[model samples]
Target: MESLIKKLSKSHKDCPECPSPKVVHSFFESILGLLFPDFATELLKEEDQISEKIEELRHKLSRILIRNKHLHDGDGAEIAHLFFLKLENVYDLLIQDVQAMYDGDPAAKSLTEIIRCYPGFYAVAAYRIAHLLHSLGVNLIPRMITEYAHSKTGVDIHPAAKIGERFCIDHGTGVVIGETTEIGNCVKIYQGVTLGALSIEKADADKKRHPTIEDYVVIYAGATILGGDTIIGHHSIIGGNVWLTKSVPAKSKIYYQAKMYNPASDETDTYIIKSEG
Candidate 1:
């Protein structure tokens, strides 16, 4: 046991370049606080204090870049400034997402409820922020932020995914949006949905692997759509538990026809349980 401990301690000492997870998490929290000041406290209610909050955000981001030595190749202050320049745009997108959730789900009571409690909203907000960092060519930090969101929300959205405006993720748990997945505006997806690739070959890493979901598409829970060429066309409805590998045309409704069994007659029956077009 002593020898094992010594070896483990040696391994830890050797890897001094590893980024601290605690610092990453703290940075993410700071970003969230800046974005939604009402999230943690009522301290941001006054309109006059907005500039102070922005400066605080800028300082925190600068500190984060300094702490993570491997990700400090460029001007940290400049990057922070650039990020804040698009802060209003990010907030606008988040508002649209919240509105999408409220409009799509009949169970949603108010925008306030969705903003305060919805895990999907939380995940989407994190994704938008992380995606901005990714687009700006900032390394490591984007993945860290998104992974933190995934850990909290069970929604695994790769920072590289291209998702459009008003995208709604209902229930969100077990939802996986791959790196190359492209989702269009007003698309709504439920829990246990995988917009994933059919293959995970190392050679296919640079290629488009995940499916494309066009505008106004609704993918129900447990639907798995795979392959790069697979596209769910505009205004389509994908039913629950359906596995799709090929492309579907616009205005299409795809569903699985389940078989029903009865014990009394020793006979099997097949029926279309759900349908919508």
Candidate 2:
């Protein structure tokens, strides 16, 4: 047992200190608290004390980055300051998302309700934050932040996915957005939707593996769109449970037409399905 303990200690000493998932999550929570002060009773209101909140957030971020060895003291401070400077733009995008959610869902009572109660909004907020970090070339932390949101919401969005403004994910549980997935603006996706790769090979690592979703496309629940070159064109409606690997043209409507079996009728036939376009 003593020998085993010594081996473990040696291994521990050899490994570099990775960023603590707990600490990263705490930082994520702190950022969210600043973004939505009303979510937490003790959080300082952004409107009331913007400068103080920014400073506190910047300090916390700098500490995390420095501790993780991702950046030097000066670099960490500069990055944190720059990130906060972009916070207003992020806030605006989040508001657009909230509005999109409210407009897309009939059950949504108001923008405030969407902001406060929607899991989709929560996931989007996390993704937006993570994506910003990813764009800034911050490693590991972005994935950690998105993974935290995935744990909470069951919406797995890779930080590297290029998502546009006004993106709406309704009933977002089981929604998986791949690293190379490129989604356009005004895209509405339902639960169990996967914008994924056809191949999971190691050689395909740097390639565009996931599909591209064009603007105004409505992807329904349980739809799996695969392959990097596969593009769901603008104004397309992909129906629930549809499995697609090929690209569709603009204004296309693709749906799975299951054959119906009427026991009394004694007629078993499948009809041709056509795109609305």
Candidate 3:
């Protein structure tokens, strides 16, 4: 083992700390097993088997990061290992998403269905994992994970966002939840939605760039709510494709103008009209 470590150290001249990730991950798993004795058996039934799986996953992640230029020579593997050590949080996040899936929809037949079928769960799970890495201060890997999920699920959640529990997203395609955004519990968003910044210009850097969404708000498909200081009040329902830049009262329902196509002629145009209700 010593000779093998020396060989690897020589081979990875730029990253001397590569081997630390495995050790760090192992320590983390062991500590978790120690803390939760009730679930220890299930968590570590075949210790060798689970360790092998973790090592396999770590290698895959490391290779991907290295190949993609996400991991660098000077980047300490210990930093990443520390992040992986908090795997329990990842499990907790999964439970939250699964429970939300089971309770949020009657159509969800089983936990297996929630795990297998829901794109929302997938996105949220990715986000939770990414958020953990982000919190641990591993720069590129978290973004890479979330970006991978974005590509697969069409839900683009920035890893830097602070998300609370019981969050459920439905049909979550084309969703852009921005960095610096904070989402409270029981928030639901649909496809083609953007909870993003009002400005990306240099003047807006220190300012509020994205909206703060309170609890129980449902942002329907195709809505674009922007600005950092903008708050969508608790229990508000934002209509689809609506462009919002200001705060709304709790329980407020904002309806957006719908587009009508003229099939008669080649010329195309659109208009916006407020609702009477």
TM-score of each: 0.87, 0.90, 0.70
Kindly indicate the candidate among 1 and 3 with the higher lDDT.
1
lDDT of 2 by residue, 111-176 (tens): 888988899999999999888877766788999999999999999999999999998999899999
Question: How many clashing residue pairs appear in each of the predictions shown?
Answer: 0, 0, 2
In candidate 2, where is summed lDDT lowest over 10 consecutive residues? 67-76
| Regions of candidate 3 where Cα sits further than 4 Å from its true position | 1-48, 55-77, 257-277
Q: What are the per-model C-alpha RMSD values against the true structure?
A: 3.2, 3.4, 8.5
Evaluate all candidate structures by whole-model CA lDDT and list the values in order: 0.87, 0.87, 0.73
lDDT score of residue 22 within candidate 1: 82
Model 1 scores worst on lDDT over the 10 consecutive residues at 268-277
Model 3 CA lDDT for position 54: 65
Better of 1 and 2 by TM-score: 2
lDDT of 2: 0.87
Give the winner by TM-score. Answer: 2
**Per-residue lDDT of 81-136 in model 1, one digit per residue for the tens?**
88889878888998899999999889999998898889999999999999888876
lDDT: worst 10-residue window of model 3: 31-40
Q: After superposition, how far is residue 56 of candidate 3 from its true place, in Å?
A: 5.6
TM-score of 2: 0.90
